[model samples]
Each structure stands twice: as structure tokens, then as C-alpha cells.
Target: MLTDAQLLAAAARFGTPLYVYDAAELDAALARVRTAFTDTRLFYAMKANPNLTLLARMRAAGVGFECVSAGELARAVKVGAGGSDILVNGPAKSDEEYAEGARLGATFIVDRAEEVGLLPPRSRVLVRVNPALEVSTHDHLATGAGGSKFGVPLGGVPAVLNALRAAGHDGRGLHVHIGSAIRDATDFAAAFARLSELRPAVGELEVLDVGGGWSLDADLDGIADQARRAAQVFGAQLWAEPGRYLVAGAGVLLSQVVGLKATAHEFVLLDAGMTELIRPMLYGAVHPVLPLWPRSEAALHNTGTYDLAGPACESGDVLAREVPLPRPQRGDVLALLEAGAYGAAMSSNYLTRPRPAEVLWDGEWRVIRQRESVETIWAAET
Candidate 1:
């Protein structure tokens, strides 16, 4: 773990409300995935963090990408992600996006029957099935199983595949996304078994993609266990799309403490609010916070109990509740840990607040992105 002093030095140089990413950590993560699943291909899910600098770093590490939107696909293309290597996936894709991806020659993971009609002739396709497995994570992050709006239900997928086969669509694989931030390996195994039961022949399956939900802060050993199990079961080419597990802990969000307020409960207001990170207020997401000033007893100080709220006007915009942290004072720099995924990408300009800056650190810790100015925000509005 990098010391608070080291992070503070970087924050002081880069300015507050900045995202500092550790490129070495990301590379190490990719290496771990490669080492663990020798037969499996790891595609970094770009929806988690779309910073072009991060994308470029992942590209350099030889990791493929899973793009959700056409813009993300375009970014991947710009960063040298070949269409044949990149996997195009999303719950709801526009016809234009579908055409663009097919025209560009990318592999498309078909999530619905309607998507098949939009595909170009001779396009490669993979069937995305909504396994009836429940994702143990937060409700909002749960993407697989029957209730999710993300994929084609299990019963509907075979028929769609049959229809596509009858139409001569190039259906070459099976894709299943159980959930996001999933911690249980047993759950993953169960989901895989279900997908396997649906499609028996390993020879016919070109790729069996277990959707990207491997979480980092959770039981990575469990994830490895599950991956090993699936590798043994499915001899076909394996693929995984992991977002948070790759980048969550590798990045940090630095914000200035604007003020402190005490009502029925104490609150530490931060300059970077939900406009910068909505996971907290949006899904009751919890992130560890570190205070830069008045460092006293490390044990008593950072026992990690505080309500870190954002500056958004809505009371629901609170970042974390009952979070543990060292005592923070006004103007103090607060480093939010495990903010690499869903941190800056989900930022908005709600309440007219200026979005924060982003920077990437390649072990040496240099600024890769600059802070946004008030003039820049106003210029867009005007």
C-alpha cells in the first residue's frame, strides 16, 4: 500500500478532485488473470472506467476490451483495439451502434432476438443468456438471472439461436453474465453449469464468455476457484469481462473537505460529490476514506467511522454512511480508496457542479489528465 504522504504529495501537485490510477497495479491484475486462466481471454470491461489513458495502458498490456456503447467502441478502435479482437456488448444497443460494430468486424454478443435482425450478413454472433441465478451483490449491479433487463432469458435464447441458425446467422458462442460485483465462486459455478446444460457440445462452441463481474475487493481466491472449475468443464475457448476487479482498488479519488456539519448526525461535505462518484448515493456503495490532516493515533483516528456526504442538493446524494476514517478538517485532502471503477465515468454536471479532473500514475505518479476549470463548464453551458 502506498503511504498517505506519497498520495498527498501527488494530490498536491495534481490538484484536488483528481483521479489517480496506478498503471502497474492494472498490469499486475491483467497478469494475474492471464496466469490464472491460461486458456481464457480477459477483456477489460470499458464501462467501468473509459479513461482513454487507462484504455491505452490496458491495450499495451495485451488485454482485449468489452465495449458497451459505440463511443466506447470508437475509443477502443482509436486505441488500436482491432475489431476481430474487441467484444461488442450491451443490453440495449441502437441499430446504428450494431451496424457500426458489425461493419467494423467486431464480435457481437447478441443479447436479444431483435438484435439478430440488425446484424450484417455473415456477422459472427454469441448468444447472451440470462441465467436465473441471483446475483448476491447490490440490486442495481445484478445484471444476470431472470429479473435482469440485460440479457435474453434462458428459455428464449435457444429458440432465438435456432431461428438464427435456420437463417444462417453465424451463431458461434454462448455468453452469460451472472452479476456485477459478485463475490461468491459457488454462484458462478452454478451459473456456468446452467449455461453448460443448455448447450452441451464444447466442440460447437467457439467462445463461452462468462460476463464481466469478477470483483477485486471480494474473494479473489473464490473467483480463481470458480474460473478453474469452469476451465475444466468447458474445454472451448473461455472469456471473461472484469471491470471493478481490474481497476477498482488501483485508483484513488482525491477531494478537498469543504466543510463539516452536525445535525442529528455529523457530515463531512466534500467538493467532489455525486457528480464525481454516484456509486455511493446511487447504490449505497461504501468506499474507505482517508484524512490527510491531524494524523494522530492511527488506530483511533482511522477506525473508519464517519458519514461522508457529497455537496449535491439532494439529500440522497450522500456518498457513504458510517464510513471509517481519520478525523478530517476543512481544506484537508481526502483520499477515497477503491474508486477506480464507476468513479469518474458516472460523473454528471448535476446542480451545475464542475466535474473533477482525472490523472493516471504509472508507478512514478505523473499527471495524465488535467483539472476542469469553471470557464470550461460555463463555456459548455453558454
Candidate 2:
């Protein structure tokens, strides 16, 4: 694991409010999966981290890209991700996006029966089977559960297949993504078994997409094993769309401590708030937090269970609530761990707080994304 000092040095040289990604770690993650599941097509879900550098790296590693929107598809293309090698998903794609995806020669996962007509003749398409399988995770992150605006429900599958047969849609694959940040491999195993059961209905199934959601904070070896099991069960060209698992633990948010306040309660205020890293407040997400430099060398403190917040004026704007870590003082660097995914990408200019830069670490450091300045924010403002 890279030390916080290295990250802080990169931030100090490049400037604070940064999304620093470890390129080596990313390669290691891909290598782990490739080595474990030799026969599986590891699709890097671009929705998690669409940085061209990450995309290009994954592409160079001989992995495919999974996209949900036109912008994501365009980003993959910009990074040499072949259109033919892309998988287009998402339930609410606009006609323009669908046409663009078809024009680019990308494969799409049809989420609705009506959209089957939108695909071109001989179009490479997959049927997204919504098992309505509920997993133990945040509700907002659960997509396959019944009542969510995700893939076609299980009961609707036969109708979809019938529709495909009627419309002459050449469906060549099955796609299922149950949830995000999934900690249990059994959820995936169950979903894979269900897809396997439906294989007979989906003729000549050339692809079986076990969509992304592999959790990074937990033991991922279990995830690897489950992926292998899925490949074995499906017995088709297998695909795993992993987003956070690929980069969550490999990246960190480097924010400088600005002030400490003990008003109604003690708080370690940081310059990075919901504007920079919104996972904590937005989804009530928990990212292991720590100070760059421990306040004492003798022993670690109880972390005081204080809120680590930002300078944003909004009362709801906070990074972590009641997080326990070494009490941080003014000007100390606070490293929010496990923020590689959905951190900087979800950033905003709310409260007019300018976002930070991004850097990539590969033994040596390089500036990947430049920090945003107040002037940069105003440049687009009317």
C-alpha cells in the first residue's frame, strides 16, 4: 500500500483537492482477475471512472469497456476502446444515443421489449434479464431488485424473448446487473444460476454479462471465485463489468484540513466536502478515513468519532459523519480511503466550491487531472 505521504506530496506539488489514482494498483487488479479467470472477458465499466488514462490502460490490457450512456461510449472510443468491443447498457437511452451506438457498431443490452425494434438488423444485442434479485446493500445502489428502473423483470423475460422472435432480433447474449458495491458473492452466484436457467430460451447465447458491482472494501478473492463459478456455469463467452472493484481501493481523496471547530460538537473541517467527495452524504457511504500524519507518535487516538466536513455553507454538505480517526489539526492533510470510485467523478460546483485536480501514481507521480480554480468555475457561469 502506498503511504499517505506520497499522496500528500503529489497533492502539494500538483495542489490540493485531488483525485489521485494508482495506475500500478489498477494494473495489478486487472492482472489478478485475468490470472484467476483466464477465460472471462473482463469488461471495465466506464461509469465508475471514465478517465481516458484508466480506459486506455484497461484497453491496453486487452479488456473490453462497458458503457451505459453515449458520453460513456464516446469516452471509451476516445481512449481507443473499439466500438465493436463495447457493451451498451442502461434502460433509458435516448434515440440519438441508440442510433449513435448502432452507428458505432457497439453491442447493446436491450432493457425493454419496445427497444428491440430500435436495434438494426443483425445488431449484436443482449437481453438484460432482471431477476428482481435483491442483494444486501444500499437501496439506491440496488438495481436488479423489483420495482427499480433497471432491466426487464423476470416475468417479462418470456415476453421479451417472444418479442425478439417476432421482431427477428438476433439476441446473442444475456446481461444481468443486480446491484452496486455488492459484498456477497452468493448474490452473484444466484443471479448467474438464473441466467444459466434461461440460456435455453436465449438461442446460441454467445455472451453472458455478469454486470459490475464487485465490492472493493471487502475480500475480493471471494469475488474472483464467484466470477470463476459464473464462468463455469454460464459456459458461454463470459463478461464481468467491474467498476468500483477495479479502482475503489486503488484511489484516494487528498484534502487539506482547513479548520477545526468545537461548536455544538467537535468537527474536523476539511476543504473537500460533498462538492469534492459526495459518497458520504449522498449515499451515506462509509469510506475509511485517516490523517496523513498521526497527531502523536506514541500511540493512536480513538479518532474522537467527529464529523469530517467541508467549508460548504449547506448544512447537509458533509463528507463523513461521526467518523473515528486521529484528531486532525489545522493544515493537516486528511486522506479519505477507498474513494477511487464515485469520488471526483461525482463532484460538483455546488456552494460555488471549486473542485480539485487528479493525479496518477505509478511508483512516480504524474498530473492526470488539473485542479479546478475559482476562475475556472466562473468561466462558464453566465
Candidate 3:
């Protein structure tokens, strides 16, 4: 929701490879989800952009946190999230995760069956069940496929429940997360329908968490209705964990084009690439480019095809391919749209490159996270 002027202004002040988040967009996204799921409690999946500032904002907005690691749990705690406000989830959780999660009185989302044994006795829990259905997303993002490692198969839920009961744990209900960026609304219906079949043997429940994997433009009204109906059948409270959907569209990665090159493929080299935003390189994510020029709209009419290459040494360092943009110069700034979620959260110091700074645009530009310093990159080393 930021104008080109605001984006360019942030880039100019904060430097290239900067992340700019629109506060209005964030509020709008939360409002949409709340409106659609009027009765359901919404949790923000912290893995999608867990900047402390952002987490604090979400917490202030009365959004709960879904943490998958010790660090994320600590972040939630730092932001004053209580046990009831946190849902600890992850496959192969670490000892620290269990210990911290237990100490904080957070609900554990049991991933595998054996995880039940590791939980604190009589702990509140929700067993994650894999629907094992195909969804419209990248192969790596498909957690519900038959062979996926995310959750126990659909057939294994009853046994896990029995185990939870045997272990003296308070297993409230069930949890099912198909995958990320699921484009099909029918996927939710089919998956939920399949899950509903287990209601007979599973019996009445205390909660039914229909995990979130909705696309930015997914039909929330339809999805929320399906989820609510499933929860109603179980006579339980509905819960959801929306990760990327809440934050992806609110962000833009500001990268300066270093230059153009003519090689085996035409390339527009950028300072920000795999290190800054790896979603594109990781999963063929297509981030549209917007050149910061008064005549940019006109320039799109006169375009050229090129790969938006990054400074990474690998040949697969291209962020986007066959991108059509006006010829870019060495100092041209380009805004990569929809780089918010999984953008800064997944960035790394690969090749000793420092991660970019992040700024929030509420009304005025506010520095949320300063760019990582060079000395701090290796300060942890001996």
C-alpha cells in the first residue's frame, strides 16, 4: 500500500537491500482475517517475519503467537504473550523448545506420535494430523502429501490421541496444516472433509485448529466457514495460524540494480539477491519488479526481458527470470513486491554479507531493525 515515493525514500535513507513494511497493510490484513473469522481466535505464525518490532505490534493488536522454536518462544515471551496466547509447534522439536514451551505454560502442537512422550505430563496439547492431500504449491511447500514429514498421517491420529490419553496429557483436539501458499479453496474443503471423517472415532473435542496456508488473495470467507463448520461438528473452539498471508503483501524489498550484463542470459545484477530474499531462488517465487522512476509506467510499455540476478556466486543466484522491465542503470532502485513474509526472516550472512535493515511505514518511516553491522557478523566466532 506504499507509494513509489515512500519506497524510494526508505531506500535512499536506509540504503539498498532494505525491507520496508507498510503498517496500514498490516492492519488491513489483520482486519480482513478477523472480519472473516469472527468467532475464531487468530495466531500469527512467527516464522514468517519474526522481527521483534513486528511481533510486538501483532501482540499489541491482540494477535496470538505460533512459535516453532526456542527463539520464537522467547520472542513471544519478550512481547508479553502468555501461555494461553502461545502455541508451540514444530516437527522434531528440540529439548529447549519443549522445556521453554512447558515452562511458559504454552500449548504444544504435537507433531509426531512420539512427541507425546516428550511432553510435560498432563500438558495441554493438540495432535497435528497430516491430511496427505495434494495442494497447489511448490513441492517443498507441500506438507500434506502422503510422504511428507510434517505431521502424522490421517490414519494415525486416533492412535496419537490414545497415546496422549495414556500419557496423562490433556489432548484437547486436532490440528491440520496442509501447506503454504495453497491457491485452491477446494483444497481446504477436501482436506477438511477428509478430516471430518475422523470426528466419529475422535469424539467431541475442545478445539479444532485448521492451520493456515492461504494465499494472499485466498477466499478467507469460504475457508473460515469451512473451518468453523468443522469446529462446530466437534463442538469446539476454532483456531488458525496465518503466517505469510498476514505479512507478505505488506512488504517490499528495495534493491539497487548494480548494473546490466550480457552473458549466456541477459541479467540485471542487483545488490540484493539470494542472501536478502531467497524465496524466489528457493521456490521459483515470482516477485514483480517496479523501477523507481517517474516514467516507470511508460517504461513498462517499452520493456526488455532479463533475469534479475543477484551477487551470489552460484549460477542459480537469479531471483527472477524472464522479467520484463525497462533497461536499468547501475544506481537504479527496484522494488520487489510481496517480499515481506519469509523475506528478512530467512535472510542470512552467507558469503559474509550482512542482512538488510527493516523499516516500518505507519505514517512516517520508522527504523524497526537496523542493518546488521559487519563486525557483528563474525563476532560470535572464536
Predicted structure with the largest TM-score when compared to the true one: 3
- lDDT tens string, model 2, 1-382? 5776787787678767788888778887777666655677778888787778777888888888888888888888888876668988888888877887878888888999888777776667878888878797888998888878888877677678677757776666678898898888788777777766664655445677778787765455665567556555646677778888888888888888887888887788887888888887777788888678656754364457788878888787778877766766677887888888888778888866777877888878877777777899899779
Clashes of 2: 2
**For each candidate, what is the lDDT?**
0.78, 0.78, 0.90
lDDT per residue as tens, model 3, 1-382: 8998888888888999999999999999999999998888889999999999989999999999999989899899999997889999999899888888888999999989889778977789998988889889998898888789888888889999989988899989999999999999999998889889898889999999998989998999999999989888899999999999999999999999898899888899999989999988788788878888556567767778998989989888888888877877789899999988999999999999999999999878889998998898989999
Lowest summed lDDT over 10 consecutive residues: which window, candidate 3? Answer: 293-302
Evaluated at residue 26, the lDDT of candidate 2 is: 86
Best by lDDT: 3
| Global local distance difference test of model 3 | 0.90
**lDDT string, candidate 1, 1-382, tens digits:** 5578878887788777888787777777777777666667878899899888888888887788888898988989888997667888887888777788877788888888987777778778888988887767888877886787878887777777776677778787788888777776677878877776765533356677886687675555566567556645655577888788788888888889898888887788888778888888877777887777766677464554567777777888787788666767788888888898998888877776667777766667665666666677789563
**Superposition error at 367 for model 3 (Å):** 0.8
Output the better candidate (2/3) by lDDT: 3
Model 2 regions more than 4 Å off? 217-235, 298-303
